[model samples]
Target: MSINRQIVLASRPQGEPSADNFRLVESPLAPPEQLADGQVLVRHHFLSLDPYMRGRMSEGKSYAQPQPLNEVMIGGTVGEVIASRHPQYAVGDKVVGMGGWQEYAVVNAAQPGLLRKVDTTHIPLSAYLGAVGMPGVTAWYGLMKICEPRAGGTISVSAASGAVGSAVGQLAKSRGCRVVGFAGGPDKCRYVVEELGFDACIDYRQHATLDSLQAALREAAPQGIDGHFENVGGMVLDAVLLQMNAFGRIAVCGMIAGYNGEPIPLRHPQMILTSRLRVEGFIVSEHMEVWPEALKELGTLVATGRLKYRESVAQGLASAPEAFIGLLKGRNFGKQLVKLI
Candidate 1:
């Protein structure tokens, strides 16, 4: 453990990122005895690969600062404390924090919200990076707080098989709403309907045009969509707009279609005025107060087996770049993680 291995941002991407944008680097690790008073050494077990990280890689203006070149790529990590010079942390403590793309990290445990101890008795340590973590909280806040669906109403979700979208559908179903999902292919569509228990799942690829997608949505959501959770934009959003009921609420989570710098101009901007839709975009990190409440429900659902989740895991830290690229292309099923242990 004398050397720490990491994936650093080598260059900013122009559109789609390739392996050239990332570089693997190694650095000498200071011994436990040489650590500063408030610092702790952590050995990362798992690293999370999220879509939002793509936004951070660019130098453009964003909600958060862009990832600095030649630094460890920004990410969420769950690990074990190997050495501690802090009062609250001790060796073997299971914790979660922003440990980035490195196999090991030395961070100040004294910094509030930087590190947190988690219980693995009910939920696995890896779940701290997924369902019972940020993605789950993002789902809860967007669905419950923004797109409030009433019982017997219909809810439409895009990117239905993804980590956040899956949770949004399941949580909405629990509240007695008829949930319909929109996914890329037949296999993903089947999983969304049969496995995740959505009322129906539309294979968006089959309906390549806005009019075609709108026709399919009409059948799945016969009563019209009362609430919508959008993940993919472009044609999908346009179709959802056409089917939305009057005064329907929409929670805009992601626009992965435009992440590669493609222009996603809405075909029908006037639909918002005609439908009286309330569409709001949110960044989950900005609302910290709701996390505790969100995590409590998400943790219980996951622990009790009511909330089912999936993960596509890569073998080592070196595989992160490929795994992340695969995620953007929808090659990975469910939550994507890189195992560093």
Candidate 2:
């Protein structure tokens, strides 16, 4: 209890990420002797593992700044406030914030929008980091604001069984649109359609080649795709482009397939021009203004059991590296998380 455990990036990855890139270290759980005003100490219980973290590990031009090496890996954490010298926060309050990959954090309550208490009455505590947190917000903003679903229209989502994609499909369905998803395997495809209420689910692995993927997508989405919420950008994007309806809209949330390999190129860049498609890529963090409204709606859905989600949890902090590596390979199902408590 007196030592703070951390999972820090030991080295940048080459190709697919591995456990050897992360190093675990321990530091004394020490607080400042003279507490600054508005200071609070947090003990992290859960940490979110996401695909974006892969980008942070590499020193490359990205939408977000690279995470510093030899420091606790940057991530979202939900924890309890154990000590507070601030007016707003109090001991025992459950809060969600970016406390990184550490067991403890000392943050100033006056820090603008860094930490906030979460309501755990109707929603599960861990759900704050998954369904109603950043991922949920990402889904909401991308699907509603960017994709702009049309009722009775067809929407195709890639990485359909994971955190952001699952929310996107369900949300689109709620708008009276027919939603289809591209997941990795039969099991995930089944879950996307049967459990998450998607109209059709395509197993991308079953159709690895671009031609096969295009055929499968065409078969699944007979009407052509009106909107796309893309997660895996390699073959999935290519296939979707071929099936795109005129004036189709694409909300490019992530290109995870290229995270560990050579950058994926669009097989048909001309489709955007010929078909008059609207394609927009976004980083969720850059748009914080929409979060309040987005989280409110997403939270209500998850709490009422209308929005469904699943989590793949690793037991401890030490497991984050391996869990993260598996995430890049599409090994974990649903939302990947690490439980430090």
Candidate 3:
């Protein structure tokens, strides 16, 4: 029997999750005496920590189901196939899928959302969980399919230094769009503008007001924002709404500001009608059909050094909860990953 440590939801969080909400427990893993036809045992390597996990802590109807108390926390991870009863996946294959917060997982090879083997030599294995994975695909399809940015158009992206936002800004820049980014601090803002090639970057935390944001937007995008990649919804969304040009496109990727359970108030709902702005919310999973193509493109960009990515890696599963809370607080600089040896 093998023993594995896993992080489970100990209690439902009232607002922002504290350390008390999670509990790490060790369980003895006994292999099935009779092998299931298509089951495989996986050993997790890198676990993804996303902002969406915050919503899963609360009991409510969301895009994804909430995690029940005492259940292993849900997350995407890159793992290696340790044992396989399935013909499709053999032992020693590196795969990516939803393995939750555990050292080992039993998965069906033919399952709808089972692990998919990837070529890690072309790119780092962790990139599969970030850029070449969900966040990358989210930025790609969200901008192309949802926002439909035109060449030479001006676009604004919030959380500009983050995984998804960074991809959005860089992709827009490569497409000849004037890309403006909104980040928390001066360092992040500088990184976005200098490293990511953004036309301008606003330090939202420094300015801290709608008027200041609008003024910055006017300075960055004098013609007005033709497209906006809305990562942070609350006040930033409200401010961007006022600066949007006619028939502007808005891809609502995430609402990190409101993820802590605070009610986010919208100052202007009429901007949608007046500017004929197209605002749409989407989940990256919804565009699974084009995963192969998106990965190919993003991987090429990363290989050629046109696209860059960063990760805030927390060492060990014990640090996952703290890393998760830090992610919600915007303390992480890029894609947050929990490294498990």
Candidate 4:
């Protein structure tokens, strides 16, 4: 039997998650000959660490149930199929799925929408967990379906250098919209503007107060924001609300500002009513029908060198906890991944 190293949630987080909240354990994997019908075993190469996992960690009433304690932490993974009993998958097939924080996973491949084989000829296999995967579809859904940004309109993105936000900015730019991004530090802001091709990017660190942030947005988006993709809530949302044009569309994705149990009260709630703004919240997982369409466009953009993204990979399964904590605190740049090998 081959031993598999995995990370499990040791306890519910009090505020921000720490190293103590997670535990590492080993489990024995059955050999390929023992696999049941329709089963496939995958050896994960990279594990995706995202903000939504924080919500799943809590026992609160959210869209999904809390992650069971002492169980493998929930996450997206990209890996190769080491063994397969399913007709659709082969032993050497590269796959992407919700394999959690484990080195290997045996999944029932026959289950619909559970596992997907990806082509790494042009797009890297690791990208299946980020730009060409869930985050990319999320950006497409919120920007195209909800915001409905028109050419020449201005679009604003918070947490702009992150996986979803970075994709959102690029997609908005491709649609001929003026893209403005908000990131934590100068380096991320510079990358958003210079590399990610956003029209302008504001470093939220420089503008601590809501007034200052809104003033910066006013200068960056003089035409007024027609649509906004919100990742971080609280002050950032409030600031964007202040500069929004009439009838602007706001897509609420993640409220990472309050992920640590802190309050994220919006300073300006009246803007929605006065400006006739349309604010809608969504969970990308609930909309599986759009995955094919979204992935097609995102894949082309990535393969052709039009859509650009970055990653901050932590080495080994032992590094997952610390890397995840850093991700929640906005410490990691681009997409945060654990290189499990």
In terms of TM-score, which candidate is strongest?
A: 4
- By lDDT, the better pick of 1 and 2 is 1
| Every model's TM-score | 0.99, 0.98, 0.97, 0.99
Candidate 1, lDDT over the whole model: 0.94
Higher-lDDT candidate of 1 and 3: 1
Model 4, runs deviating above 4 Å: none
Ranking by TM-score: 4, 1, 2, 3
lDDT of each: 0.94, 0.91, 0.89, 0.94
lDDT of 4 by residue, 196-249 (tens): 999999999998788898899899999999999999998889998989899999
- What are the per-residue Cα lDDT tens digits for candidate 2 across 1-341? 67899989899988888899899999987764545789888999999999999988888898888888888999999999988898888899999999999999988889798999998999988999989999999999999988898899999899999999999999999999999999989999999999999999999888768998888888889999999999989888998998999999999998897887687988899999989999999988889999999999999999999999999999999999989988888989999999988
Report the error of model 2 at residue 86, Å: 1.0
The window of 10 residues in a row where model 1 has the poorest summed lDDT is 204-213
Question: Clashes in model 3: which pairs?
Answer: none
Query: What is the Cα-based lDDT of residue 68 in candidate 4?
Result: 99
How well is each residue in 179-287 modelled by candidate 3, as lDDT tens digits? 9889999989989988889999988887778888778878888889999998888878887899999999999989888787788888998999999989999998877
lDDT score, candidate 2, position 230:
91
Query: What range of 10 consecutive residues in model 2 has the weakest lDDT sum?
Result: 28-37
Q: After superposition, how far is residue 229 of candidate 4 from its true place, in Å?
A: 0.4
lDDT of 2: 0.91
TM-score of 1: 0.99
lDDT of 3 at 180: 89
User: Going through the candidates in order, what is the number of backbone clashes in each?
Assistant: 0, 0, 0, 0
Off by over 4 Å in 1: none
